[model samples]
Target: MSHDARVFLREFLRDPARVAAVAPSGRRLSQVLAGAVPRRGVALELGPGTGAVTDHIRHREPRRHLAVEVNPRLARLVARQWPDVEVVCADAAELGPVLDAWGAARVDAVVSSLPWALMPEAQQRTIMTAVQAALTDDGCFTTYAYVHALWMPPARRLPRLLRTAFTHVAVSPVVWANVPPAVVYRARAPRRDVRAD
Candidate 1:
């Protein structure tokens, strides 16, 4: 196995629920997720396992690249691999506070590799709420779901939650090159009333 896969597997073995995958995302899925990042402006990444997607995001050269990884080991690995990226060992659900601590007023894009399907509904809502609040008026959020999970309740619930939080949500074509395949969801235009209702 490759170094990235080994590292990812170690983490997965340590905490299956949090790591969610046996290996880091493939190059194709990484490219697709990073596509949402603007060429310039602040960009945030959640759960950058082994920095696979981080490589693609760096190529886009966003003004500021902030990555939040809940795992301390993975966070340190990403930080060492990409010294330029601001790596924070924090929960993605606490995005608002993370951004505030970083002094980022608003982010232009959010590329996430988090396992949304594994999260509870309340946790999903909490993370989405933070994402909606931290985004700029035109900022976009990108994340993926495994193809096999599309019919599952948690997968189905993600789009529903996103629709309620953002004005526009688009799902990309399935990336078959990825392990088990996956589809990326791009959401834009945060709804101001997301918290009111």
Candidate 2:
């Protein structure tokens, strides 16, 4: 954590209304990334708060990855740490242009850590729509949500909507040894419609 990060984290902790604590464990990251990501293809990541998932992506090299972070401060940190990875400081909803600029016409997968439960329903739909548009026919987009009683409504509904965009949707539990256990939702891109010749 940088000096500035400490200050930001302190302030975040004070309220933490929007901040959900579901820090990715190295083991859990390996599991989800391995299962969801293809061996070699363009990958995209959203809301990489402190490079927890970013580190995993680096460790397991994809063909290339475009990581978009809304927070400029965190974006700088990720760029500095993973200089090889493409880092963009922008909203998740605005990923199309950035991905095109990065030469990612179609991504194979997107591993996200964007606190989805906290976002408004409309915002969630927008971001997921962007994700769907960016992915290849077989691409998968994976994200995690905190395990809590109150967050259930959105949590349950997200997977269903993901089905509309992706061909497959699966959720798995990852019990974090550190703080709170989380469930990772893996959604595969919708299959392309093929016509019989």
Best by lDDT: 1
Q: What does the lDDT read for residue 113 in candidate 1? A: 88
For candidate 1, the per-residue lDDT at 89 reads 99
Candidate 2 accuracy as TM-score = 0.83
Q: Write the per-residue lDDT of candidate 1 for residues 1-197, one digit (tens) a residue.
A: 98889999999999999998887889999999998888977889999989999999999998999999999999999999999999999999888888889999689999988888998888899999888888899999999999998888878999999999999999999999998699999999999976512
lDDT, candidate 2, 1-197, per-residue tens: 55545644763575354445523344665457545667666778887767767777766678886789887777898898788878899988787778777877788888887777776777778777778877788778888766763356767667766776777888775546424566777877554452101
Measured on C-alpha atoms, candidate 1 has an lDDT of 0.91
**Residue-level error in angstroms, candidate 2, position 179:** 2.3
* Local distance difference test, candidate 2: 0.70
Best by TM-score: 1
Q: Which regions in candidate 2 have their CA more than 4 angstroms from the true location?
A: 1-8, 14-19, 22-26, 149-151, 176-178, 191-197
Error of 2 at 58 (Å): 1.1
Total backbone collisions, model 1? 0
